[model samples]
Target: MAEEKPLTVVTCTAPVNIAVIKYWGKRDEELILPINSSLSVTLHQDQLKTTTTAAISRDFKEDRLWLNGEEADVGHPRLQSCLREMRRLARKRRGGSAGAAAPLSLAYKVHVASVNNFPTAAGLASSAAGYACLVHTLARLYGVEGELSEVARQGSGSACRSMLGGFVQWLMGERPDGKDSIAQQVAPETHWPELRVLILVVSAEKKPVGSTAGMQTSVDTSLLLKHRAEAVVPERMAQMIQFIQQRDFEGFGQLTMKDSNQFHATCLDTFPPIFYLNDVSRRIIALAHRFNAHHGKTKVAYTFDAGPNAVVFTLADTVEEFVEVVKCSFPPESNGDQFLKGLPARPASLSKELLSAVVLEPVPGAIRYILLTKPGPGPQPLDDPNLHLLGADGLPCPRA
Candidate 1:
């Protein structure tokens, strides 16, 4: 029967993840359990990420959320799932019934503000970073600790992988309640210093078919997706992990390319067919193969998520040389100087031999820009209270 503290606030950020083995289907929709195990590389939040802040106050009347400076429905099921699970863990950690029945608003409403530094819903794993940051910041505010990837999973299946840094894998567990479906880090961020990543931002426009809706359709109708989940991903997951541990670029690049093609194949096999890639994407795929063929070994790899943008992987030794090839094939029409961001990529000479060896229809202005990044750490809390997204009134600040 004592007074309870309120106006609690916390802010955090999580990086995006690009699935290499690819997660194409879901077994349990409510639990957000993937139909197959998948692996990914968590990108540095410096290049692409989502920042979120969670706040709770005794005077707040109901839960509210804002995404990308716009008000969103708080009644969303997946969002509710994340919030409920975090609150449940907090109550359980605080001695269950006693904390639930206290005078404090354990039932207190909250205000959530989330925004992405990268384009939202562009298949750049915005949902993954968004949910992971949300769960982590909420845990900080509610004092809930231990495994939180599972909590993020309830928000979005791939979000679980964003909980860890570097190479991560989401193991599709057999539990009906999905307690075992969790993310495990394959290696730390500094595992491979030579590794490099280039994100070709093809378009910032919203994708026609979203990953959630596209995945559901594949699960319901695509036989190829079923075969992939049962017969393909298991072996590929093991091989991908082995290649990463051994630093075998040739092996890793091959699997990455094949898995991306097959994931798109499953999308095509869906009854209505979902198309995430465009002419720009197809050209990039061919360019990658031709570039590798010219090198007589696998020196570069390209993978597309649920969008037209391509995620290219290579080593630092040859990254500059390869990026020069990209510039020649797809030159920017205007404002070309801002074409590349993140790590500073120095210019490398592109000879006619390299250019003529790769046959690609030059498309000016196809890509918006490029993000140069590599693997980085998991979600991190901000030390500055001024960075909080919520105002004193438990609402999103002006900029949100």
Candidate 2:
């Protein structure tokens, strides 16, 4: 290894997405292939996202990874898959014999450093953002590009969705090689410019049961999961797509809520049972329904993943009213918790009658904060070196 070897580095940021059509089970564990195609709205980078930097150099003796300012397991199968695939593609596309990808140091080892703007493993899909950033950033360094979501899918199933903007669907393709299973854009960010996603961070602490293990158990044990994947998903996916195309918030909200409920239902149907939603989650569900009923339509929709947080979806015109409903109902500053954050919106007062009609018990402590955001772009390059997460020494840098 040459101590003075120059390095090639690239850094990029990838947004986090919340599944409206949840992916709960996997048919192939090794490849991280999903049993059903899932759809999600890619969030704006204003709130939750992951930033990663990939540095390749002859001086580096081994490949290493750092996540959120801490050294992570570079040997992780998914991480290795992303790294290996990038190198393979680079070698095949650019590198020549003896693994020379370019005129320079294409065969050199890489050091990856990633950091998330949000909590990890709290069912906010940190892995999705992290892996997407890794794959995108690595591709930038390797000079291999075009539809890299398929490669990202090998790392984390949902991570593929982050590869595109706005509404995305990970098609559960028929091919066994998993080549056809890729993320595709359903609609661009401009399609639903009025739409907003308000994430209620219930518990930022690491999930007691990770999605990987929980979904694995569901695949092995839950017959409901099997039925849902085989019978329920295809039709639901079609309906969801149509709803988005038509901008049918009422229909979309109804289906989104139903799909989330069914996803959790499959969780209960699993042996020994897994509960992602607690009292707070259940209350949020009720509130969404009652709030919609008060207006006689679905003004906002609520969805939950394999964790307790609630993702509330609504339109821009209605966002302020709903945010006030949530704040007045839950009180963000209560108990000294500064929980309300995201998209600047004025507080619209909820009627005393409306508040009474909501008929929900308040549990402010259960919710950590509310993140306000909208749909935005996919993985984007950081042109400025000031934003890079890796140091010139090919090591992790202290976060600003």
Candidate topping TM-score: 1
Model 2 spans with C-alpha error above 4 angstroms? 1-5, 95-106, 333-337
lDDT of the candidates, in the order given = 0.89, 0.87
- Over 235-261, each residue of candidate 2 has an lDDT whose tens digit, in order, gives 999999999999999999899999999
lDDT of 1 by residue, 46-132 (tens): 888898998888888899999988999999999999989988887787785453543235688889999898899877888899999
TM-score of each: 0.96, 0.95
Q: Candidate 1 — worst ten consecutive residues by lDDT sum?
A: 96-105
Candidate 1 C-alpha error for residue 121, in Å: 0.6
TM-score of candidate 1 against the unseen true structure? 0.96
